[model samples]
Target: MSDVDQSQLFEFLCRMGDNTLVLGHRVSEWCGHAPVLEEDIALANTALDLIGQTQMWLGLAGEVEDKSRSADDLAMLRDVWDFRNVLLVEQPNGDFGQTMMRQFLFDAWHLAMLKALTGSCDDRIAAIAAKSVKEVQYHVERSGDTVVGLGDGTSESHRRMQKALDLLWPYVGEMFVADAVDEAMAKAGVAPDPATLRDAFDARVEAVLTDATLTIPDGGFAHKGGKTGFQHSEHLGHLLTQMQWLQRAYPGATW
Candidate 1:
């Protein structure tokens, strides 16, 4: 492979790894705090799945870059500016309704991306996607069900759900925004171009929202600046500090 292709592929892998790592951390925070025992376990399982996916994706990324970095190193040692996760995943879990809304939005796009990625020309990418798609399917079902419940249920739930959706809707656009990394990887058959997933993502999200009796915000302001590594949010740093402290202090310490 050419240097350009290698670079793009490496970057693309980091992007995938970072998305899961950050979101997994966010979800994992719900470990002892979920509203009910069942939800606590369910979200914890989702978080574990995401963190496992991150290890796989980032392990592949480490190989692609030919760097000595392991998946653990990539996840725990990287500084904030180097992370490529979209801003949506790093957004704080406002409340249970907000967290579910964020989960639903990301689940829709993530599942679509993985479905397309299952056909990736790169066998490793395809293999990972094939496995991950199954897990993400569950994420979609759980989150989507909750969204419908909250949006279509009582007055308080409906209002909170709507508030969460409005606050998060702008971040949704970042998922479908294509960059040079996407262009190169798509051309090399290593990954799908995210731009192509927009329509289908929109349709899936709309269907869920409609069933829940929620309205899509007319807001045209889409937040950006995460993929290229210049994140405008402070949450990532705070999260990384908590996530990386043990690894940083202990260096290679394992249970």
Candidate 2:
């Protein structure tokens, strides 16, 4: 492979890993804080699943980069700017309703991406995608169910669900925008172009939102920069501070 292909593949792997890592941390914040015991346990389990996926993706990323860095080193030692998660996952979990809304949206997109990856020419990539897709299948089901419950249950719940949808809609666009890394991955048959996932994503979203009685906002204004590492929200820095503190403060400390 050419240097450019290798670099882009490493980047693609990091993008996959960082998405799960950041979002896993965000979901973990709901532990003990969820509305009820059942929800609390469910969210925690979901977080664990995502974190487990992160280890594999980032572990492969480390190898592909030919760097000595392990997954822990990449996840805990990197600054906010080094992260390549899409903007959607890193957005704060606003409230139970909002969090579920965010989860449903991302789960829909994530499942599509993973399914596409199952057909990847690269055996390793296909293997991860096959394994990860099973977990995300359940994730999308749970999150989509929650969204429908809230959106169609009561006037108050419906309002909050709609509001969350509007608030998060912009970030959704970034996931489908093909960039240079996407181009390389597509060329290498490592993965499909990001735009190709949009149709599946939109179909799932539309079906769920329709059942939920929610309205998607009208606009094409997408917030970029998160996955590209060109920029991130102020929240990412704050999140990194909390997430990396243990490693940063006690450098090389073991669990």
Best by TM-score: 2
> Clashing pairs in model 2?
none
Q: Summarize candidate 2's per-residue lDDT along 1-255 as a digit string, tens digits.
A: 343487889999999999999999999999999999999999999999999999999999999888798999899999988999998999999989999998998999999999999998888889999999999999999999999999999999999999999999999999999998999888878899999999999999999999999999998999999999999988888889889999889999996
Clashes of each: 0, 0
Residue-level error in angstroms, candidate 2, position 25: 0.3
Instruction: Name model 1 segments beyond 4 Å from true.
Output: 1-4
Q: What are the lDDT scores of the predictions, listed in order?
A: 0.92, 0.94
The ten-residue window of minimal lDDT in model 1 covers 1-10
Top-scoring candidate (lDDT)? 2
Cα displacement (Å) at residue 128, model 2:
0.6
Clashes of 1: 0
lDDT of 1: 0.92
Backbone clash pairs in model 2 (N, Cα, C under 3 Å; residues 3+ apart or in different chains), count: 0
Q: Measured by TM-score, how close is model 1 to the native structure? A: 0.96
Worst 10 residues of 2 by lDDT: 1-10
